[model samples]
Target: MKIDREKLHSPFVEQVERVSGEVFANCYQCGNCTGGCPVSFAMDYGPSQIIRLLQLGQEQLVATANSMWLCVGCLQCYSRCPKGVSAASILEALRQMTLRKGEDHEDVGGLPFPFLKDAPQQAIISGFRKFVS
Candidate 1:
């Protein structure tokens, strides 16, 4: 997508910063976060790409991606970030932003009871903490 010069001042960046508690403009697209992400294989856009999207103020992709839901809160991205971007926190912030719109990022409503039952308690509880109202 073409960069909009006017949108460089958009509210999207501030919202992300507010929720993520990081100065997102510091990100330099070094790809370190993506390289270190444990779950990057599961992400449509890995941590570095998400940070790049946020840095570019690409609100549409940043807010709507399934990548945020794919984050397992492993903090590998945060640890490897030389610029302290905390990409996982930005992902979590995006998830919270989606929830603030009264929409869920994860749709596990159709999962069989036994399937959920076999999952670890931490997984179930964390899912609730992240997904439930």
Candidate 2:
């Protein structure tokens, strides 16, 4: 986690803000979002950590992480955020950014059909909508 501050600039951070309309910088690294996230155990970084990374100007690191897909549009983080940061929407925006570039962070294509066959309909649709080329 050695961030070369000189290399920190715009691009991804600006897009996150522009897309999610959430000022992630206002986040105070509180654990509320992470504690409230139902899928935090499966995520490499939780909702609060995501905001922390964004605030630290590690937008690319956050964007490339697999944690974004773990948010199943659950608004618990958003609801619990004292700073009004929409953590779910920010993750959604990351997914949107990845999708817009014809890429996927979750690698759904790597999973076999049978592995995903029993997945919920909502999850399948959401995955497709976010990852399909």
Candidate 3:
């Protein structure tokens, strides 16, 4: 991907930076975030990849990824980051952006009955909080 000046300074990037309060440019592709993430195994794109896509001005790709929705906001990424970039915060910004567009990441009605029945109440509530608008 050819990252040009226009892409780097794009409105989408600006909005993400403003909302996340973290500079994407500061991230240098270090994999600490993904390595430390407990739930990264279940994500389509790891935290580091999400930031990389954003850095490459691939906001549309980032927007379409399920990575942001899977983030548990544990801040393990932040704790392991050398530049103090919080992937959790970036994911939250992406989620906010998606929510602002009136799109829900998950459908409560579409959730599987087995998982719903077996999952802890707190986990279910947290899923609703994160996946619902």
Candidate 4:
């Protein structure tokens, strides 16, 4: 597989820092964030690994991972971080970046009618905001 040097040359780390308002350098890989995350078991990469990837300017790896999309925004990571870095916010920034690039994580029209009917209104609305472009 060919790596995109252009993306590597881009200010990916700075952009993530700017968009998320969190410093990647502050993370010490303590694993507290991942340990505290309620949904870490379901993620392709834990919060610490994601932050490390960001620190190393591995945006493509971070972008391709399902970890960001799987983040539940529960703030457990932030609460557990000694530096108070918010991985949830970083994931949100990643999602926003993907959305701004015109990519939708979920197909709204493809949602099953039965599931839509059975799901709570709050869940449906939240899904739309999170998954739709």
Candidate 5:
């Protein structure tokens, strides 16, 4: 499918840029992000592809991609990037964007609570209370 680079001027694109900045612009698709990604095997499109799709304003496809939600936030891609691009953190910000849009995810087969599940219940409850406050 053809991607319209012009559509990248949309508000959603701006949101991505505001958070990620020129890191997205520096990506050369070297596949280092994908190679360093621990969960790339489970991702429909690797980290570099996601950045490309975002640059092309493929918002719908990006929002629906399961890879965004599957990222383990290991920072491997971020640390290994030759361009010093924080692809892992960028995926996180993108995931937040996806969730903020109230998009529905069909690929709900991964972990139940990505962040909270890793922490103790007391810590989780404390966080819940903080949110409720």
Candidate 6:
């Protein structure tokens, strides 16, 4: 629960700031993102919590959280946020950080749904391949 901010370093934070400075920096921990998140029940840390963690440079929490990969990218929290924080985009950035660090979700991989078989999954996979390749 405690982040050693001195240890955190990454260029991706700059990318997040560039793309979502208003929303990412304006978060007041109102928990609105978590309240509006349709998939909060399925996440280890809700959307707002992730943002708070990231703000504190808690890269371990963000990198290790399985919820980063669980995000459906529905953008519900982004659309509903009063602060205009794109919760979904924040989740995506966390997911990218996790992947860049080689964090893997073995449990998610064992799920019955084949990511390639689902259209949304396919789209995500395609996008990831494009971005990470």
Q: Scored by CA lDDT, what does every candidate get?
A: 0.82, 0.81, 0.90, 0.87, 0.73, 0.69
Could you give the candidate ranking by TM-score, starting with the highest?
A: 4, 1, 3, 2, 5, 6
**Pairs in steric clash, model 5:** none
Sliding window of 10 residues with minimal summed lDDT for model 4: 1-10
RMSD, each candidate, Å? 1.8, 2.7, 2.0, 2.4, 5.7, 4.8
Model 6 lDDT vs. the true structure?
0.69
Identify the candidate with maximal TM-score. Answer: 4
Model 2: clashing residue pairs? none
Q: Candidate 5 on 2-102: residue-level lDDT in tens?
A: 66656776677778777765456788889898998989999988888888887788877776677866787788988888998887777767766665665
Which lDDT tens digits does candidate 6 get at residues 34-88?
Answer: 8988889888899888887667777667666766667777888888788888878
Clashing pairs in 6: none
lDDT tens digits by residue: candidate 4, 1-133 = 3446564445877888889998888899999999999999998889998998887678778889999789989999998898889999999998898888889999898999999999999999998899778
> For this target, which candidate reaches the highest lDDT against the unseen true structure?
3
lDDT of 2 by residue, 1-133 (tens): 6566643446777788899998876888878988998999999889888887887788667876788876888799989988888899988888888788887555766887886888888978876776665
lDDT of predicted model 3: 0.90
- Per-residue lDDT tens digits for candidate 1, residues 2-110, read 6886556578778888988988778898999989888888888988898777777788887767788889898998898888779888888888887888786456787
Query: Which residue runs does candidate 3 get wrong by more than 4 Å?
Result: 111-119
Models 1 onward score TM values of 0.87, 0.81, 0.86, 0.90, 0.72, 0.67
Error of 4 at 37 (Å): 0.3
Q: Candidate 6: misplaced stretches above 4 Å?
A: 3-23, 100-133
Better of 4 and 5 by lDDT: 4
Q: What stretches of model 4 exceed 4 Å from their correct place?
A: 1-9
